[model samples]
Target: MPDENTDSLRPPPPTGWRRRIARAPLLLFRAGLGPLLGRRLLLLHHTGRVSGQDRRVVLEVVAYEPDSPAWTVASGFGAGADWYRNLGADPKTVLQFGNRHHAVTARFLSAEDGAAIMEEYGARRPRTARRLCAFMGLPSDGSASALRRAGRAIPFVRLESDPPRRLESDPPRPFV
Candidate 1:
């Protein structure tokens, strides 16, 4: 939309106060208050590719399927983001949404699939979509084509979990 280089549009990883603010949600997830944030966000437990140490980050959910218990998330900061790259190195990981933790594996989606998902997300949440596009330095006009373009440029990951097993303490409800 901006005619600028796509790479230039991508934001660098946050630092200083911005990094601290961006990571604040992780504290909530760690404190078992993730449910308070609802299904719109999820906590990802990933491993550092080089360090081989566990890492955690909270990401926004772009699409979710209750039946398959899958959550689709976009790397708004582009593929260079540490979490995204780590997943590329090793897709097997864990995802925590709300109060439920799932043993999930990451599946990278095709550009076409990402386009479709972003379009659907824009339709469902126009304001949020526009904001996300703007944040990613994409067009924030909220048009289907613009959102689809943004989707194509960004990387999307689908976290698929094992078949749901009901636990005694867990309520009979779908995991978002």
Candidate 2:
């Protein structure tokens, strides 16, 4: 794959018929249901590598590593993928999950480390990681062991959930 700059993996799919078809579902989803369900969708926002502007993507969180509580993102097309490239350049990003926003820092990890974490997720959860890997066409290996050295195979993030939003004032205090 091309280096970070010249990489063809980021942005949209490679220009062609297959590319159009490949991304049709995402387009349809965003057009039809994105607005109604945006708050419920788990979204990630990453800056454009070239434009230096923000870009948002709806993603399904596959697994959260225990002990460390690191989030794992399977880079289906590997480091050459657009999201991966963006994170490589800038690890800082944001995530919208469960009607909440989080400031996050992302880091890539080795295949072994990713696989181990994947294993843990698959073992504990119901095919969240396995399904995601299969959907992304990533190798589903070692997906029950704890991640040993997560450093670029997968993009994992550390997140701080944004504080709750308050609107109306609290009700009158009850007698004690």
Candidate 3:
């Protein structure tokens, strides 16, 4: 029911510099290589509300869960980011990784989960921790607790991938 009966709340796509960046991300990345250079690119396919069709977008792959219920992906620019907004509006989406397309449902991460991951991130990538924190717009409040608090504010999407699908020209299933 996530996408149902939300007629009055509909609006146009995001615009301005963000729109420009979305349109030509390669150029933006070229212009700012340090923070913007990304290796993994994922194509997300979602249902368009007004257009009543499928919408495909290229997103930079961020985080993946180890043995958790969902895999998390952070919006580099924070909550107001377009892809985050779209997934929030509609949970159903498909992530294209190379030639494989994975059907998925996305949800915002719980406060506890976000905090734990933030700690892990700081520990694992200490050299870039401060800059990364600032990039998420977290103020330097001095307390380590402040970092955890900021983690809760930074939006994170957890994607739950669907079961495997079979192709027409595939071999039989492997034995258990």
Candidate 4:
């Protein structure tokens, strides 16, 4: 049996049609609808950490730095999410944002950096920030401290592009 803390942290996985519903966006992206979503969202082409099978997931874009070709994304389901874990195991991945696609490496940011990013994101998109925080089981009180705390709790990954892809035979670990 799982402990109370584990149960609390583990959000129920979507099932049946709901699972398909979640993947509909990925299908749209595959069908060349990426331009429609623009920079607000992106398609993460990743490899499964355990199975080593290819996987795709659509995630919201919290921040995009064009010059560095870096994108910051939050895991609304927290760090325990399968995709997040996959990236941790192997940061080599592909990112498709709008019409641009790049070979990217995932870098986990420090809590302090996450806090600042979250604050700036909230200022730009208040409602979305609140909703995301609530969904992630973080406090959504709309205060700076609360936002910072939530940012610290939730995992933020920076996808930096133009990196050389590491061979599969390489050990499972972050490039950075």
Candidate 2: regions farther than 4 A off: 1-41, 65-70, 125-176
lDDT score at residue 172, model 2, on the 0-100 scale: 60
What order do candidates take by TM-score, descending? 1, 4, 3, 2
Clashing pairs in 4: none
Q: Can you give the TM-score per candidate against the true fold?
A: 0.87, 0.54, 0.60, 0.84
Best by TM-score: 1
Tell me the spans in candidate 3 whose CA falls farther than 4 Å from its real position: 1-41, 66-70, 127-129, 140-144, 165-176
Once fitted onto the true fold, the runs of candidate 4 whose alpha carbons sit more than 4 angstroms away are 1-7, 163-176
Error of 4 at 99 (Å): 2.6
> What tens-digit string does per-residue lDDT give for candidate 2 at 36-155?
454323566789899999876655455644344345555545466667678778887876554445667776555555556555656665355555554443445433332222212344
lDDT per residue as tens, model 4, 107-161: 9988788889998888898888898777656667888888887777767899998
How much lDDT does candidate 1 score?
0.88
What's the lDDT for residue 126 in model 2?
38
Mind giving the per-residue lDDT tens digits that candidate 3 earns over 98-176?
4455688998887677766666665665545566566545653434576566566556677888766789899898899
Which sequence of candidate numbers ranks them by lDDT, best first? Answer: 1, 4, 3, 2
Per-residue lDDT of model 1, residues 1-176, tens digit only = 12236756787878999999999999999999999998899999999999999999999998889989899998887877899989999998998999888999899999889889999999999999999888887875989999898888878999999765689998778789
lDDT preference between candidates 1 and 2, better one: 1
Q: What is the C-alpha RMSD of each candidate to the true structure, in Å?
A: 5.8, 7.1, 7.2, 7.0
Better of 2 and 3 by TM-score: 3
